[model samples]
Target: MRNRTKSVLESIVIAAILLVLAQTFLEDFAVLIGWSWNIRKILLFTGFFFDLFFTGEFLARLYTSVYNGRSARYFFAERGWVDLLASIPLLLLSSGPAVLALLTGGAAVFALGGMLNVLKVVKAVRIARILRLLRVLKLFKQIKYTNSIMAQRHVAKITAMTVSLFVMLLFGGSLVVSMLGLPSVDQVIADRHSQTVERIVSEMPAESREARNWLAEMTDSSDLLLVKRDGTTLFSRFDNRYYTELFGPSDYQYIPREGYDFFFDMRTLGAIQSKDNLIFFVIIVVFVLFLLIYYSPHFALTVTDPIQVMRKGIEDDSYNLEVRIPGRYEDDDVYRLADAYNRVFLPMKDRSRGTTEARSSLLDFDDVKGLLDGE
Candidate 1:
């Protein structure tokens, strides 16, 4: 009989890992693409949940394997190591910086936005979060067929490919971030004094000629000038104080409009330079989809048939000449598993073919020995 408890726990682990990988970058993604802040709550909740669940699951499995005499194999097994990388590193990476931020009292995380050089260690370890992709393989461990298939030599090859994908993703994401997140050299610092002038004018008392004069006195001369749309000057933060002395009449222009009113137009927009990054995004997405499609079909053909044959042997409580699976792929794991399975069962099937002693075989269920050997 299948262990339902183990199966359900494995399924939950798979679900949590999927949630973490899917939602991990959502906050940064929203900022990059300028999405609404409404999605931040959903992203934060899922991120916290998946990190906690994976951390607990990893600890439980680590302790159980150690206590159960499989400590070396548990930590060294393909599945075991992948689970370790996918869970613990992610838990620490997501939480450590946050804890440090809280302990140091109300600053942004990531060493309060990379303030401390020592905590740059967190940046180096952040790379391991990419290994969380390996958690996808854990879902297979619940299915005996897919589990065995993934445990084969192909694991090394898949790990290499996953690492390569990680590199490409990081490169592409960094390119996008430079374009969307970083400040340009020519970007202007908005005039803070203009904001003060707007607030003072809007909140002026019912009577006071001195109110408007005080606004001019309070603001600095190289700051932004506030002007009405009809060419009437409201106040000169710059032009009235230092007009034509440090500035030319041709240097400034009155732009008509909203809140902050008028401002300088100095900028070196990098939009044109980042055109290739968008193209790279499309290419990488298509490349990943192609890789998935190429390998997925091999699972159905190589894994399902052999496992079904073995499962039926246990379910029916007897072996028979019928339903024997022939090996088709010599290099594949399923072929090896099925070949071993056929060797064990073919002898039993042969003895039954010549006898009407099947009831005796049913009574002697203990004959099933070494069935899981070498799996």
Candidate 2:
């Protein structure tokens, strides 16, 4: 029962890993593919579900190891570290600081701004899940169940190739896409500034005092300057900064409203376009994943099934000249091997029987002759 439970959980984990891989590769193009934004939420939910499941599995194993007084074995020998990694939703870890920054305001906002940059770097740590993909090697280990050594080798080799191909397409394609699709640093900064402008303008407070308070609450007090068309300052917040640095910095946006032109410096905004222009790569990955999954079983069957059948028949004493394997074609290597085996085996069996019968006949004649002499 325990083994059955383990098998079921392992199967679920494998399925989850595949789903996560598909989700990760295809997520960037979700909009292009006509999937609603809600798809992202669903994916996130499922991702959390799988993470929780893996975490529970890891804890269960840890508990069992502790009970057996071999907790070190679970951590080191059994790769519990992998389970721990696979379990963690590192992307979710940023939410705490984000919430705190939003609720607390001021210095916490700056801290969140720095953390946002750090999380951009944290996104790369997700590639570490590639190590978790190594868990899929368990599928190769299952090939050992095949009776034929040759069949096991063939299946394992192809399985490894298939896995390597999928991973290469996933990670390598993502890398190429990232390199090609990434915007220039200046472009990114400009985009972030534009986004910040848009957000602040859309959420601009109606009353002057309210607007000033909102601006102060949202970012550094001096980050925004509101000046009239006649160059008279209406609502200006200035702090310890040089006029040269504040006035003509490239990372600022200007918007002309009814009474005033607003100048806002981009000190609060983080990366707003982290993943864009990946539709082409997403399509390639989906197609490759589909093709691999669709044909892999057929390929494995073609390569391994014939050898397994022949080996099993030989073990069962069912393959011979009289009852040979029936699927022989000129181009079929496995059937040709069966044909060769039958020819050699039946000829050897016939030769051994013939020699034994001849020796028995000679002995029978000698015994008869000796009996007559005694008579």
Candidate 3:
């Protein structure tokens, strides 16, 4: 029963990790597809469901660890903080801003601290559960599990592959960004606009009669009239030819006939023009995340499934070595693994048979000894 419980717990942890990765990649994909606004809503719903299951299991294990008095130090110090941050979405909804702010600040600080001790924290959590599962495998220590060696090697290979993929993504993003020249484009446009505006303002002499009269009219007009760089006007008292050309027929409809206040707002304009570039960046990030997820299952199968099979085979003597894992591999690692296990076990099986036959032969000689005594 203890072994069964441990097995279930380990399975739950693996499932949680997979779900987290899936949701993360999916959210990134949605953003890349230019559905940025909707991605948040989708992720919120997905996370709520995932958190429900993960939170329950985490709490249960936490309680068990506390009750057992096993390394409560790490649990309370590191895992406890992660549990708190993981619950932030739910907690913030129920608490006041002040309380939420305090918790949020505390969580940020704790997270920074947690990063420093991440390896230790992960080891504590994974190792503890693994140790529990190993207890159930104590019986299998006597049996020669065929694919155990292959499974261990595959786990190392998968780890290296994942790390390499992550590094590639980092460099790829940097190269793409450099080629696009978004930063340079933005800076050049902004600098030119600034210089044009400065030159226009400096040319209008404050002492000139025409300039003084123009200033007076602007101040006297009920409707606001302000000249902006590139002939753009905001709430202008006069609908000048330049304004007419820039705004077109629809401009008069949106801008009141009466002059309006022109607040210098550049951010709105920038946002309108930068939408395409933002979408491009989002797409790149999403594509990379999707590729990672698409290959993740095969990666997990190569590593996880083999170890699981070896573990189960050790526990149950009836485990079939011929039960081939589903899915085809170009490299045939799984096939090679199965072949290796069979080779190792064939000799052990023959030795066991030979010993049984020799014992039977000795039993037959027992009657010979009895006949000699009778003679």
| Per-residue lDDT over 18-126 for candidate 2, one digit per residue giving the tens place of the 0 to 100 score | 6755654454344334343355435545545555665676688788899999989867645565455445533234223333333464246446447554324223333
Where does candidate 1 stray beyond 4 Å?
Answer: 1-8, 25-28, 98-115, 118-128, 143-375
Model 2 bad stretches (over 4 Å): 14-39, 55-303, 319-336, 346-375
**C-alpha displacement of 120 in model 2, angstroms?**
2.0
What TM-score number comes out for model 3?
0.34
List clashing residue pairs in candidate 1. Answer: none
- Per-residue lDDT, model 1, residue 176, is 53
How close is every model to the real structure, measured as TM-score?
A: 0.46, 0.45, 0.34
lDDT (0-100) at residue 69 of candidate 3? 80
Which structure is stronger by TM-score: 1 or 3? 1
Of the candidates shown, which would achieve the greatest TM-score relative to the real structure? 1
The candidate scoring highest on lDDT is: 2
Clashing residue pairs in candidate 3 (N, C-alpha, C atoms within 3 angstroms): 223-259, 224-259
Give lDDT tens digits, candidate 3, residues 1-375: 999988796766666655654564554344344343344445645655555554565577677767878646535432343343343333232122213223474354236436643222221221121111111111122122233444433433343344334434543453454346446433454454454334435554444466445544544522123543234332244455644333211011111112222322233222332343344334534543443344344555666566566556544443535425555652477646655555655355456656664232323567688798998
Q: Which scores greater on TM-score, model 1 or model 2?
A: 1
Report the CA-based lDDT of candidate 2 relative to the real structure: 0.50
Clashes of each: 0, 0, 2
Candidate 3's error at 132, in angstroms? 37
lDDT of 1 by residue, 1-375 (tens): 368988786677667655654565453354345343345435544655676777777778889988998978877764576667667766665444444444464255534446543223333333344444455455434334334454333533464356446644764564454346454221223234345446554664433455446545655443445534235445555554444342222123334355324543111111211233233333434444443454544554566556766777645545543334444576577677666666766566656656754454454445555554535
